[model samples]
Target: MKKLFILSLLVLASCSPKELTEQERWEKHAENTEIIRDDFGVPHIYGKTDADAVFGLLYAQAEDDFNRVERNYIWAIGRLAEVEGEKSLYSDLRARLYMTEDEAKENFEKSPEWLQKLCVAFADGLNYYLETHPEVKPKLITHFEPWMTMYFSEGSIGGDIERVSTRKIKDFYEPNNQLAVSQGLIRTSDNEPRGSNGFAIAGSKTKSGNAMLLINPHTSFFFRGEVHMVSEEGLNAYGAVTWGQFFVYQGFNEKTGWMHTSTGTDIIDEFEETIVKDGSKTSYKYGDEIRPMDSIEVSLKYKSGDDFKEKSFMTYRTHHGPITHANGDKWVTTALMWSPVKALEQSFTRTKKSNHKEFYEMMDIRTNSSNNTVYADADGTIAYYHGNFIPKRDVAFDYTKPVDGSNPKTDWQGLHALEDNILVLNPPNGWIQNCNSTPFTSALEYSPKKEEYPAYMHSFPENYRGIHAIPLLTEATDLTLDSLIDLAYDPYLPGAEVLITGLLEAAKVAPVETNVAKEAIELLKKWDFKVSESSVGMTLAQFYINTYYRSGKIPNMVGNKRISRLGRFEYMSKTASPTERLAIFQQSLEQLKEDFGSWKTAWGEFNRYQRNDGEIEQDFDDAKPSIPVGMASSSWGALASFGTRFGKDTKRQYGTSGNSFVAVVEFGDKVKAKSMLAGGQSGDVNSPHFSDQSQRYADKQFKDVAFYREDVLKRAKSTYHPGEKNK
Candidate 1:
């Protein structure tokens, strides 16, 4: 038996391609690419061709954080269950529902020759990294294939497919199960708002007469790495690339810059399918005809104990899409845009666009389904696209919820044209800003009129950040890169102005006032509605607002029905009872005293920025040394958002998300930019690059980006090929 097993292993080894060894292939690729590490440890990759640039980009990504690269792919390709166990099985199923392994491979085969080359290079780059670094062990994927790139084509952290509910999937798949209501799911208007801020200023508003862009992505810390990729084939792009992705998700070329903010457009929709079963056959009603539903068996592997286990599920799909779950008695299927090949092409092509015309032509692809784009070019053109891939639906059926799948009238009537979609091009105000807000207010008088667009196009509420940004951009005349950076990090918390003033009024009207409450009110009264590390007023305001949310002092605003943060503040200020307002303030004061030994604690003492390790989901410790971060959450209207989440026993609020990668770019005859990452490029704790920029990030101090090769070499700390070790 041992001899037979050895012979089988030998046969398997011999069956592998023998044209060139994996090591030799890696050496060849390394020769085609060179990676220059700057003083701050950002990789500036130079390659002979576009494919070679992608290869070098992936190779550099692996060196910086192979763990994240592997983890992202593991989750993307529906193999997360094999590593995380049974609880993640639904997530895997959700991925497979939209695109199966066979489909991904087919998609790869159907890609254009140029894109195919990039795909092959992507796999080759990562595979070479794994082959050369024998010490780095991948949890699941040992060898990457070209097809795997299809699963994670676009750069958004969670793509449109993530809108499907895993809990609903579990309810439908499991036997004799009651549907579970998803609790604690974060919504757009949640206390910690998760999104990006993009500001595009044309030449008219800038001091240097050059269009400027603010690329501030509010994602979890270390979610993306900052890199500069250059190729002889005109692939010179610099900015943030999501870990494991070859393309720069948010960045700029020589003449243009683009930033993406999550759009509130109704793109993903659920359809209530009328399912019918006859004996062993199942069909769904479509119009007046009955169409047989597609059924497939999906086998999943999960880690159990010391061994691997398997679970097989029979999945069903309808014409609308995959039957994700049941809505009451009706089977519900989710419909979302899933054009991986085109999406990948559009994502990669956008980085190379030189001007507004080229960028506008790229938007014709219409595969960017989940984001609103803010664009600026060296030609002094600034634009804002509300949403790219909007499907035209019948006005009779509301797309915000599940529509009737049986009625063909409810189906999407192809995609809307780029011109039809809500777009702002060179608004007379010379600026465009989108903080995940309605496009109607993107610019002052020149903004797109809400009444002119379809009702489905502008359902998102106007946020406090939008309200806060309008005045600043409207009054601005001479803006520079440094001034734009300062504007992005402005400390004024507009939401607090309404809520704090209400508290002051409540204090004056209090029938029974405690000395501590009066002192707190006095501090609030003197506050300028701005946040700073040492501001005691900010500390009080944060606690008071948080306590209001937790104590249920106000009515719960459920889902889309929820009002804007500014509206909520208005309600508290104008409608809430004076007694309730004072009571909420009292609770915050007491909690502050209990947590930090005093109610007069500074905001810096409670709000902190700490990074103890490189773990994807970090653990925070109050005892560990951490820097004080002055920025507050976007919920409170802080443009430079620094949101926090606390551990079970931790006292200080440690920042977990917000302001991950921030860049200010000035597009002139030569593109000049400054960027800062949350921590640094490398994720290894032992690597000096891991936490080198943590203090600078907290201070809002950005490092000048090295876009040109000459600048990169000037700041180069070490330069080498992929396989070579840097000293």
Candidate 2:
């Protein structure tokens, strides 16, 4: 542990440059002709030439945090060793198998003309910045290859993570190991966030009769939103792209807009490879046949600082993928069959698509990464697509765990035809949304059945976010844009009134007899679920939920696998666990009593987004940075949600990370949307814009997203080409 800490320190210390005074000039070849600098410092790059816009965007990103940019690049280039020394060496080795410089060069050659041109233009932008910012030290390869970005894209946020950390392959068996495994499971939630919130109140359901479409997607802060990079030759788009990716990963176009969240559709699998070494030949036997296997040895090298002399190496891999340790007697190497090229092609094509016909045309290309797409258009059509490029496989065995690679049955059959996947359009409910919930509940009674697809698809069942979202949407009527904004800011306690009612009802007697403890229980008993800034009951409830609620099987299965609101109310009605419950009850009572002297305080007060340091307080602080708002109650949401605490005044509190970016696209009319991010655009700490949007984001507000060329220029504050002087 000490060694690990020391290694981290050295890696961080390495960032300090001895020659920090150097400056290089950035040469701009692309045209620069737009203004972009909102109050939040978001760079709205506009250009007569799409390449010019992209060049400026890249340069702007570099200016913010070249370190992260470099880090992303380092991983992409399989050069982790250059930063973290021996510990990261193995990860680099695994990356090398598929993304070597030579391979990237070859792939670049075969790439489509449009993609190739974008790659070159993007690469040149990075190079131009490197030329200008000489003092900013870079380790390993300073220049980036377009394909390197493609390599890092292969990882699963929650998939391979469960296979032990890269450094402690040997520690996979230790009883002491406590690294969080929930992240991987989170990636495989009951419903992966594939579907976006999409539904239209047609003329029949609306009093205005204009027809309303909701294009809401709960996705990663940077994953689903980014500006498009297109040239007059063919590229023209404007919206958000997944951070670190070159293409406009997903966003709105002129005629339509779309958003994506996680869906339950499963596309990745793990296969346990069996190795057999012959006298001089290396091969593996599957069933009755012995096939020659390729051996890939990755020796990673790392140096913390400029002393380049200090380096370490680690090893990982198999013919399938990286060999990861699960525990004693088990070595698992996962095979991920994602079609990145196809996905990218599909993404580029889909953004420019005009309608369902054009959209279906792109669907035939089958370049989808994992996500559920919700689309809305000016044409009064809204659709939900539970789509993924999933490989078909035999379902007799579980694919979530490692399967015997030697078994021919485990091999992936061809992919399922797109039409086989789950999809619903124009349901009677007239509105549909997926806050990472099951597909069955996407609409009224027309939801797709699980029995229709093979088990290998590995999609999620119903999850919590969708659970709460359904009720909220159903409760509202004549929904307008303001109502949607209010829904996004709903601060209801997790499990809301249901769990509280269940707990209250389940209790046999007050867990604590003391006046203070009794008061806390009574406060909870007679309480509302709203998490308004002043509710103290919400604070107590949130803390209790945060402490106890987690991912696991429910004890009682009257109807479902989850604890029902009635069940919660019943349990809490009379405290059951005397000692344990007493301690918790006492603790909760004391904390609330001590802080505000009463439990009646609104949740927003105590559970505030501490606006300390001006803005760092906005993103919530879950123990694990990865699982931002993964509460079981789904108060915040499955894919995105925020947490905040109110100060003494109840208004001066802090807001933390939640849904960072939001977009709603209408197919042909205009993009109606709200977007927020944790930090302002600039990475420069002192810049006001750095954290300017923290309050607005916490306040559930968004600046207008300049999507069209004219809207951006009309609202331009200041813009120029990459490397162009300030004007």
Candidate 3:
């Protein structure tokens, strides 16, 4: 009997489950998570917990374009120079100047328990992906760390950190070659405008009597991926996620939606410090005392002729901020938002908010430094927050220029309360829009008064995109999701209207030369300023505008304030001589003929969409098959912005940026939304989804978003766990 009992006890011991190891725990989490790839290759991640959802989210992101996922982290964590060589050393230095690996880890350690779990899931997801797919190769980051998320907290592409000039950082730290750092970085009209257009309409203006929101972000192609993440912990959000980020940057839930536009509000400022150098110690002058400047040593590695080389720099900082560069004889400290933990918290918590009040409280976190938020809810509320991280600076100093660090009054006096910032909540016009323009013109007459706010609070001038959106929104009534898409993708170029009238006046007075120039002028004369696939006028107008802006003769300012691209267009149209206009038109004609065989080539023939491979910096070939894109650049106020690029060997320009991820959402009892990506979801050339949406994108055809569980299951193309072979 004892022998039989011993044998039975041994059998019971073998049947009992053993405790899981850390890796096994991760595997269990993966098992608990499910990712459903919809027809469009957008991942809909469902998990038992929020952390599990995040884990599956990252794994799915890696499956789509691991190159971008790894690349973002490599760049974010100050390791790009290790792969890209000496050119990126300053970029690495700039990253290190703000936060070190230890600092990031410390920040992660200090975060709330829930946030830490999310961070852990972020790392585990990417690391598990690498483990499961041994065939995949990472450029630099083979093992992602939880702390690494600290460096890339907010979702705006590159965020405010990118605004800091790496060129200036190099000039200050590199071997002695003195050059004065310019106080103002005047962004000219020639550079492709890297801002987004956001619109929110109240139920009063919508057909379904539900608030409508347009999530139109003008970014570089493939900059962000469209995704839907859901968890049992009341987390269900659909939107675009910047590569490697765990949270959705732009998108909506059943009850609320949010869109972010790059804000021109002066969130970043510079302080000129009076340096007092003595022996090995350095001090800087402040108010009534000399304060010691903090010096930190940073060493960066760069690829050098198949080998790695190291460079060390002794970076300095003051109470104002890190010394980014030198201006004249003064060391300049750049002050911007740097609350990584709070920023990430706000970014994630924002996705879970169900109502405007919850979202409003979330905004109080105030770490969204570089974006202006356009928000809407199911309750028919439409609101706009111009800038969240506005610092309360004394009105006596011009914050636009570098101010004296010695003056205590010049320092930022904490952040402005939410009410103090430029805010529009349910304007009387029933519509709100911000296209990186002045908040004063956001909602027509209903916009916040400019005179009421401090100059630093809303310094941006009215842009072409803002001018284009206002009238359309003003006249809008009973807007449906489809009609909202139509309004967002409006082909009429208001910017072209401002410039073409001047060209017509010039043609009347200027000396007539070639018949080609006469034909171009006549095409401009009778035509409405609307862009289309077959519009030869659009081709000619775009070419003329590009040529004029490239000419560098556009006035930089009117009165004292710096002008925008639209302002530059207005300046050139009114001020340029008839001969100058005619000459520029001739130049445009000659250039057009040189590129496209004839100057009469249609806009679509010249502007194209092509994705030959999955490379981040795509190579353009004129011989390669490409889709015709009817859209024009935002620089010309074409709201359906499509910025294109040309190669040295190619004639036709291929799209590279603008309107990358677009979605129109209507919030009712259940969310109804339609979205379009620039190309498709997968970055692998072999995947069926690589260029699946390219044609649809050119046609401005958006697909329905499967937001509900039943809807997701209906359209699901493939479903699997994170490490499962079926994926």
Candidate 4:
């Protein structure tokens, strides 16, 4: 048996094929250009035209995180297995299932002209960087097509980015049983979600009397922040850019600004496969003849040391979407087509748009993935809209999951007419806010009527935030920056009016123990149904609730009257009695004392966004306090697990992931406005400006960005290209 095994291994090794060397891929993308690295490392491209700025942007991003960005696109092309091995097999198939090369190409053509220019410019920018920087080796990809941007579309990364979705998740090793998940018809549990918070106090509402936009987007540290790209051709904006992306997907220029928060609305769906007939060689099925089962095999490359393997996978689908998961204990397939490329084009052009008419035209495209975008500008205009390219199905099938391919009724009836599904022009309230909540609650009394739309539209994330935002916005007769700030930081809703009124009643009955539960009960009792930072009860209340909140528990809806009635708002029924609540509080205090050797601790002490580089020495004291920067906790309370840390010195749990790039834009009032990027102005360590903003960022501070030529000239440390650096 051992001899036979050895022989089998020998034969396998002999049959294995060699994969491309890292150098080989690098050679394919090599280009040349003059690069000047300013002392701060913010590249100042001197290209002959707009494309130069793009090329410079790509090269600069490559310098910082080429590996991660390249990997991002590798997965986009449905070739993740080439680099990640067996673990990525399903992800590749999922990509192919949802999106295709031909589909992407076709969609690219359909994309708007300005959007295509930016993409093409982006490709040129990358090509320029490669030409100038032959020393940098591309791990897998050396060339990028215009449509490659579609593969790495901002939505594709939810497979990894801010929010994790159920759409493309791989079956983790264990099969035959369901893996644990935050299951729901609608997930309204984004209190600790990954998001950003922004509010515009229009000239009508602000002391400045100039429209003020708080362009704050919460994403990962060291992740992409705002980049000011300028071309005499009238291209300039502020917002997040993932490495090589040519334009800001979410942000503001002078005339208007925008913010995007994820929505649970089903923008993508999957369909099951049916067999009408089997043919020799290649198989073709009927679409109406018997309801066709669209299937395609995704071929992937896998490298195992000296050898490479090709992986072929079958993805099945109907007209609606791809069949991602297994169907009836058999292999199934799904098709995906978000056409985000169209949206990307819209975003690129809209950023430069000078008026609302153009903004409305851009909004008409509605090719965006699952997020609601809120807009504000100097024109005294503020708005929010939802529903991006939803597939109009047969209306008889469930769009939430895999539909039957055998049933002809499951076929999509083209896309919904943009106007039929467009939910905008919300009125009454002058502003709109979305903390990853339902789009219907975007504004106050003026929000879109639920009855006006169909049930198929994603009506929720019927979350506490939106529930909280509504009363907060409506109840205020007069709105201001101060009021907006207070609302963004508001604590939980009122106990008296909430679903757990019964739980509070129950809390009154439990056997009492320590002050921990007592304090929690006391806060809950006196709670004003608000999250204001100064609320005396809110601090203790949030802490206590944090302890009681479990991730996987079904929601408590009975006491949810203060908010919208949701599917699983029943968790309130499980609330502890006052005595029991007191016990929890006392236990918490005691645990903290034991853990830190003292109970006296500030909220900042526990929750920190600690940057753990693994190089910082372990200190037992206030040694590694996470650099405090960005918005406060509970303000943009998303992705609850993210928090500031005290590092090893003062160990404690805290959350952070908001306002990485915060700007206070007073439109037209000043050429330069207040802005800040977390960490520092320089991404490179060699520069003295590295992390210059860390201290200010920790303090929620701002710096004046160079909006004019003189301002940039005064502060501009160094300028360079992405290619070969010429000192």
Candidate 5:
């Protein structure tokens, strides 16, 4: 009987199929996945499983912009110096200071089985792309790994770590004795406000009697790619995905949609540690009982001509966090949310949620530390979470600056509960909007009361974009997708209303000498404060405000509170002398004339949109042909923000950021939507899609989003598996 059983076991073992290699397994996943490229070159990926869908999503992203995909991972994984040389050494160091490669791998190992599979797919997809495309050369990361996703779990551009200055890190760690660390915020003329505009309207305000959502992420142009990822395992999501990230950072599934705006809620904190080193061992003072500080040796590599060089540093950390910089004589530890596993899970599971309840439960994960979510669903629900992953701190302690690390009371008790956080659930006003502004004014009368929440719960003062969105939404009636688009691109610059009017009033009080100034004032006097291509008033206003930001003496501070951009306008109106105002105005005109040969250049002629090449950092040439853009900066209260910059030796300002990906969705029996991209889906300059949507973007003409498979097939320009030839 034993011999017969052994013979049967051997027979069963012999019948079992051979184990698959990594390449073979990837090929199998590719077989299960199908990518349909629409006429606009947006990839609509269909897969048999969630992992397969993720695999194809990353593969499609690589096909579109592998340079950006690999570069994102290289920067995230703390190896950018290996490509960019010594200049990026501190950036790599900052990444390692927060989370090392071993720690990232540990995070991947600690993740749940389902999440682990997704991470594996994320790596496999990129690796397979490298394997199939031999012509493509990577700058740093030759091979991808599942653990690399841990470094870039959250999709917010520049993430929380970017707030920690690399200069500060270098001064603290660099061996050079002359290194200087500048403390406090260095105020400068930012290109435009770094944020997004998300508006959710309930059924009461929409024409379809269904909820509506606007996904408008104001990011660096070409920062994200538009995609539609579908899987049989209940993973159908469509929206803008940050390059190389496996999940859609901001998008909607069929039944629900979510938009993320950069949150002002304080998530990163600095703890001033009192160091007490005894011989080689290091310790820190913590309420008299000294606790030993954690120490680790970090090794980093950088490119030196054709060869690579290595540098090592011994890093210190306290219970609070890693010692990032020094304050006076004390080493400061920067504490922030670093839960990679939970953050990745939250980011992925958020797209699969079907209704309000599921979304609310998902929000309970509380790992999204840098964004405030505005939500709408097919179930007639509209909601807003002011900020998630807020830590419960003692109200007695001020957290705006570096706090005493020795004081035990300053330690975070725990995270605030989902219900305890500031939120708006189907407000009576039927609308919710967050332009990276104060949540207390999210829904006017229905908005959350500021006093009801902790001081740390909300920090952002109201901005011009929020100021612009309020009145439009207050009177919004029977809203549709196109109407929402119209509202978002209203062209009225609320920011210009105050600054331009104030300047004109100043001119009325004290007349300026120059004829150009008088002509500019007359042009402004007739202006409706609406930005457009043909409007010369827009050109003058944009140049003038930019000049003021650079040269004006208006203090950024008013009493104890820091003045916002809108507040600066108030100060310029009430404080700046008429002489100073006219002087600044004259400077602006002279500057414009110097650049364009005429101060009266139309906005379109001055403010242009050009895509010269696929380089991450573009070089603008005045000689190149470019299209005129009607959009203005969000600083001027234009909801359709077009943050532009004048390249060296170039007269025209080309947009670099703002309104990278904008979408409006109306949820009902079937989802209805329209979307726009800054340039187009492909990053290769030779690809037709590289500049296909640039004209449409400038014209505010959004194309229909094909969410369903039938619609996708109808618009399909090409179709293929991940590793197959296009058909």
Candidate 6:
């Protein structure tokens, strides 16, 4: 009997599939890749092929900040609830609603051979990092899979998935499943708008007769890492890459530079579905037929003390998409673009394109749904694409509200062609700028005409930054790299100009009786509208705006006015009551005096930049060392935005976002550029790179980029393979 059992075991063992171990595959990949660290700690990865280059890029990213890399994947996949608790379960469900693990695997299997190889390399690179560093333990996801890449294909800070409200999902999927009351559609002002600034200057506007591009992304500090990726197969791109992503999200190659700004295009819409119930069966009305709704069971695990517990939910979906919540009597489903395979292909292939024609060919894929592209190349061409992946719809129905899903007319009619998009090619104005504003104002007189396109194409309003950039770019000629950098960091705040003029006029008509208020108004009247570390006027103006926003004075003055920050400022200047304006200003003075014992505090005393540790969510300390930043927020129309918010248990407002990774590139005979990061490259507190760039960031100083092989070698600080340790 023992001999027979042994024979059966041996047969089972031999019949199992055999393959190389993860370490063995990693060693093979490492042989084809090399990583070089420059003086500023930027990784310049060289590989024999594109897949090999991605392998080195991910490995280098892990070396810099493995915590962020792991955290990004944990949140991207539907596993955040397992680590964070029950409150995050709705967020996990939102991710699962768009794509399931099985669907992701199917997408991976259907990809082309070349892309499949890159996905394999992406997984292998992170798995190898774990094998090499046993000390770093992940919160979840012990083993990375190639299919997991599908969840995070396009590298926007927060993709379209974030637009779906988690609270709505929670209200719909809870145990009671009670219907929520309908709140009238209201577009509230975002506390800190998450957007970017992109500018493309043609050769006709430059001193060197070369097209120049500015890539400034105002994101959460340290959200992305600076990387330089190279391959023997004609792939060399340098820019900021979101952590855990394989592509350089916003960057440029030697021949061309590309910058992406968040667009105002209406790509995602909500549909009102008429749900039908027959006993236990559920159906949704689509056109003339009633189709059965798709139902799936989702099981989620959450941490309770030291043990793990699980919960199960039955989620419903329709042809439009998932039923997230109920609107009045109808179930509302969200519809957005979700093409993981094509998006990944377009993202990776765009890095290899060298000229305008090639870049245009890549745009034909139309998988990028959330951003606008500003392009400049060595061929002396400059172009602007308002939005990629626009879906064609009937002009009669309003897309901003929930459309009837039962109506066949509500269905999307294929995608709009590239020629049909809002595009500007070689504008006579010699420059293009988009600050997440309407493309109709991208170029002064050379901007695209809104009358020619359908109403659903765009609905973005003019912002303070766009108003600030038009005059600067229109008059800009004989521009050099230094002048462009200076222009980008210009300290003047146009939003402040409008509000201060109102305050001065109000003080003249209804002068405040308090001495402090009189002194504050006098100081503001003599100001130049420029922000600096020592500028007391900026400090006073920021407090004044904060007080007005919190005091609800503007709404009282204008009768429930809901508008953009700039629009609010314009109303305050031209229409607001003088008594209300004086009262708001007096409140700002009183609050400032109470907080700091004086209303004459400098901007530097309250606004600062600090990073004390390597934690993903940093804690700021008033007692710790911090650098004073001179820039203000984009809400105030400062192009070099340094936005801030109050920290925990502290009086000083510490900066947590804005001006993260900034670069200026000139596509001349050779690609000459200068770039700066908010902090250094590494996330470890003990590493020298943790806070090396903090002073440079505060001073608005930039370092020259090492693009050529000779330049990189000359500035190389360390070089190694994937498995090697730095000495």
Q: Which candidate leads the pack in TM-score?
A: 5
List the global CA lDDT of all models. Answer: 0.87, 0.54, 0.89, 0.54, 0.90, 0.87
- Model 3 misplaced regions, further than 4 Å: 1-21, 177-190, 556-563
Candidate 4 colliding pairs, count: 74
What are the candidates' C-alpha RMSDs? Answer: 6.0, 11.0, 4.8, 11.2, 2.5, 5.2
What lDDT is reached at residue 598 by model 6?
Answer: 91
lDDT of 5 by residue, 232-278 (tens): 99999999998999999889989999999999999999999998879
Please give each candidate's TM-score: 0.95, 0.79, 0.95, 0.76, 0.96, 0.95
lDDT of 1 by residue, 348-397 (tens): 99999988899999999999998999999888899999999999999988
- Give the least accurate 10-residue stretch of model 5, judged by summed lDDT: 181-190
Q: What is the lDDT of residue 24 in candidate 3?
A: 83
Is 1 or 5 the stronger prediction by TM-score?
A: 5
- Where does model 6 exceed 4 Å of error? 1-21, 175-190, 556-562
* Per-residue lDDT of candidate 4, residues 160-235 (tens digit): 2213233334442124325342221111123434555545454555555555555555555545634666655676
> 5 or 6, which is superior by lDDT?
5
- Using TM-score as the measure, name the better of candidate 4 and candidate 6: 6
Give lDDT tens digits, candidate 3, residues 1-727: 9999999999999999996665986887898899999999999999999999999999999999999898888888998888777777888888899998888999999999999999999999999999999999898888889999999999987888888998888788884735333221211112468889999999989888999999999988998999999999999999999989999999998899999998877899999999998998999999999999999999899888989999889999898889999998899999999999999999999999989999999999999999999999998899999989998899999888999999999999999999788899999889999888888989888889988888887766887888889999999999999999999999998888889998889888988689999888887887799999999999888889889879988878778967766677776688899899989989999999998889989988988999999887788888889999999899888898888778658878788889899999999988899999989998999998999999999999999999998999899889999899654
Give the number of colliding residue pairs in candidate 5: 0
The residue pairs found clashing in candidate 1 are none
